[model samples]
Target: MLATMSTFELIDEASDLGQAVIKSNVYQHYLLAKKELQADPDAQERIRKFNQLKDQYDEVQRFGRYHPDYDKVSTDIRKIKREVDLTETVSVFKKAERDLEALLNEVSEIIARAVSESIKVPTGNPFFDNMSCSGGCSSGGGCGCS
Candidate 1:
């Protein structure tokens, strides 16, 4: 027979899992990359400019194509976004961030599957989004357990 955990014990176990994740290589890499990105003044300036232009783009979006500055803002944001993305520190940080996110998603899926394969785990991946139905439910919409 399997032993059941009390609520406090479950909370403790969850905390332990969180600590383990923080100690993981993926998480460590993410932190180091983030730190490097923050320390890079050029990258920071590019990111700031990109965000400022993005805010302008959001405001212009309210008017759709009618806004006079809409096209300019859109073009500027795209250019700055490319610059930000091309920065070595930012690129490394983004990859590390994605890696960390994937690791967390995998852990969540494992825990959810351990309880029941039918339990829907919100994996950020679009490919596996529809694969949550393991019990042979034929519905294309999803497991439809909700």
Candidate 2:
């Protein structure tokens, strides 16, 4: 017979898992990269400028407003982003950031799948086509995840 775990036991286990994640190589690299990025003033300014430009572009698109300068600004932003990505410090930080995110997502999916199976809940369709995944869908229109 399998031994049942108490609520406290489960909580303790979760805490242990969290501590392990904090000690993982992915998490350590993320922290180091973040610190390096924060210490670099030039990189900080570039990121700020890029974010501001992206916000402006998004705002215009959100309102369905057309501006002649939109294309030019978009092109300039892309060029700036490319340059930023080419920088060693920022590039390393970005890769570390992505790695941390993927690790978190993998952990979340594992927990979700376990709970779903235990409760007899219907998980997502296994065979659904993912060709349209833009990795940015929100409201589930043609944005994918349809």
Candidate 3:
């Protein structure tokens, strides 16, 4: 059976994945900003520090499955929330949320298509003349099910 997860759990997993993406984006953005600003040392260093924190989170996210501290990620999120002022984190988190929402929409459409494709109808057969099949399989033999 496919593992069943609540919507919240799925959201959590996607958020974790998004965390990595957001960190990379911020780091790249920081690098660009640094170059454009002609090596503004303080700004570059600050972004670098922030990127490192995000990187640390990404590291936990990447290898959590292999460690006893697998649960540390969720705990770490709580810790960060408690320790850091969230004025900045929200926008980053919001961007991640939006990205995740878009991806989930695409995933949902794909799953819907897959489900739509899975329902197979039998071939044309005179047996189903009166079988009420929309496929025009009307015949007295009826469906093989008969």
Candidate 4:
């Protein structure tokens, strides 16, 4: 039988896991992609313009259709958003970000499952959303659904 770990030991193990994750390839790639994105002048300009347009859109959103420049601002925001999304640096950074998120989610799921299969883990995927607890505790599954 395995010996139970003290709270301090558990916390120490968690800290080690965190350090390992920071040094992982997925995280490194994400950092590199982010750095590249920040260094890209064109990409930065596009993102800046998109944010400026977004702020205008937010202000006009409060007035809805009553705002005079609402339509124009909305159109500009959409156009700028498309341009920003199409930028190669932005695209690479976004893909890296998603990959890093997936890695973290997988690690979280693993840790959760180690404790209990019924533990809910946010996977950022819609397909497995309802798979955490198929039956409630009242159904005799003891899945901690209370």
Candidate 1 displacement at residue 75 in angstroms:
1.0
What are the lDDT scores of the predictions, listed in order?
0.84, 0.72, 0.51, 0.84
Candidates 3 and 4 compared: the better one by lDDT is 4
lDDT of 4 by residue, 1-146 (tens): 56567877998999999999999999999999999999999999999999888888999999999999988998899899999999999999999998888888878988998999878776665443433443442446544444
- lDDT per residue for candidate 3 within 1-146, as digits (tens), equals 46557877977867876666456655455445435544444444545555566766677777767866657665765655544334344334444444544444444445455669444344233342333343333444344432
Which residue segments of model 4 deviate by more than 4 Å?
1-5, 125-146
Candidate 1, 10-52: lDDT as tens digits: 8899999999999999999999999999999999999999888
Give the alpha carbon lDDT tens digit for every residue of 91-137 in model 2.
99988977876677567667766777333222233234223332334
Candidate 2: Cα lDDT at 144:
45
RMSD of each: 5.1, 7.2, 20.9, 6.3
Error of 3 at 32 (Å): 21
Best by TM-score: 1
Which pairs, if any, clash in model 2?
A: none
